[model samples]
Target: MSTQTPTVRGDAYLIVDDHALIREGIVRVFSDTRPQARLFEACNLQQAIQTLQGEHGPSIDTVLLDLNLPDSRGLETLQRIKAVAPDIVVGVVSGTDDDHLAMQCLQQGAAAFVPKHGELDQFVQGISAMACGGIYFPRELLWQVTGRLSAADAPPMVPGVASVRLTQRQGEVLRLLLKGLSNQVISNELGISPETVKLHVSALLRAHKVSSRVHLILACASPHAA
Candidate 1:
């Protein structure tokens, strides 16, 4: 068999999950679609931390975070990673279909939210959109959040929000980032390359005029807060 060469790109990504199979599957997908994308793997939070905190740490552009790891659990997992690296984009993944909890994550700081059972195409679309300066959210959840806002009540522009005009996809990515998923997870869940996720994140930062992911999360989560 012929050997496959890795793609070279400006972006780099990390995958943090406990399952070897899942990690392998994700790597394969990225390798196939984004040959230039570089991928890193961590079996647990500690390993993830080591890779992220190393001398070459700045090269990482995005992360794929799992909620249930051997060393971390629940939202704490997301919180800790954000604390460690505020600039890197993150996407959250879980086995259960818990939209409310997922929304809570968005409110906190995840780039995207995806269920394990979601269709592969939807997942890929979500990741691709996020990579291309867009966002992705579950259709049901998007409706749930925006359904209460009347068209008249909705402004031509969201008040006091002049920096970034959120494309639907960017909004989706912002929502999930607030929720705390890592870039690799977002890529796998959305079936896209991690580098794409990084592109959207950079666009988001520029649009928001925010210096870091922490500020982006705060702005998105506390729209009413002064």
Candidate 2:
């Protein structure tokens, strides 16, 4: 466990899980760390979507979603949530600790992927990191996910990173992307169109030799990467 207490942002958060106990536990975790944060709950995907679409939706800045809800399962749950609320920061909490699944969730716009493996501290820290405008995943699992990419196909390493240059706009896009912001959010922040953001993202992927945003993030975090 970290010796220093993480600084959690006071943002409105939503917990989406069918299990009442699970939802309450997560709420308690957040409350312990961020007592000022406004929190809400939903038992399934439909309720979650409705909550996001509700009048109070605009105030919601973050969400902790369970993949095994009664109405939704696997990556589909995440997909639906992102489709409705692209700008909201989502942290996926699942019983399965599959690194590939975590990667998929990140590719699909999740800010964090935390496995519900009985580590309350890890969950709290992950949510804290995301709340503070950063991405989070278990370090071991993240390395494992990066290891799946072979050297030949991996993104540019720190040694050769100088060779891969990016435009000013692409650099701006990459910075926001690393913060787990969606294309729309980045576009808004940078005063660019979403289509323009997509072009810059494509350019960034090519420059980094990465296929997806998740891969790009992991590559940048790797010790061997720039």
Best by TM-score: 2
All candidates' TM-scores?
0.62, 0.64
Steric collisions counted per model: 39, 0
List residue ranges in candidate 1 displaced over 4 A: 1-10, 130-133, 146-226
Q: Rate the local accuracy (lDDT) of all candidates.
A: 0.65, 0.73
Residue-level lDDT of model 2, residues 143-216, one tens digit each, is: 54344332544443332376765555666677667655667778889999989999988887887787876677
- Residue-level lDDT tens digits of model 1 in 36-84: 6667888888988887787446777787788889999998988889899
lDDT of 2: 0.73
Error of 1 at 163 (Å): 18
- Top-lDDT structure, candidate number: 2
Quote the positional error of residue 193 for candidate 1 in Å. 23
What local lDDT score does residue 165 receive in model 1, on the 0 to 100 scale? 60
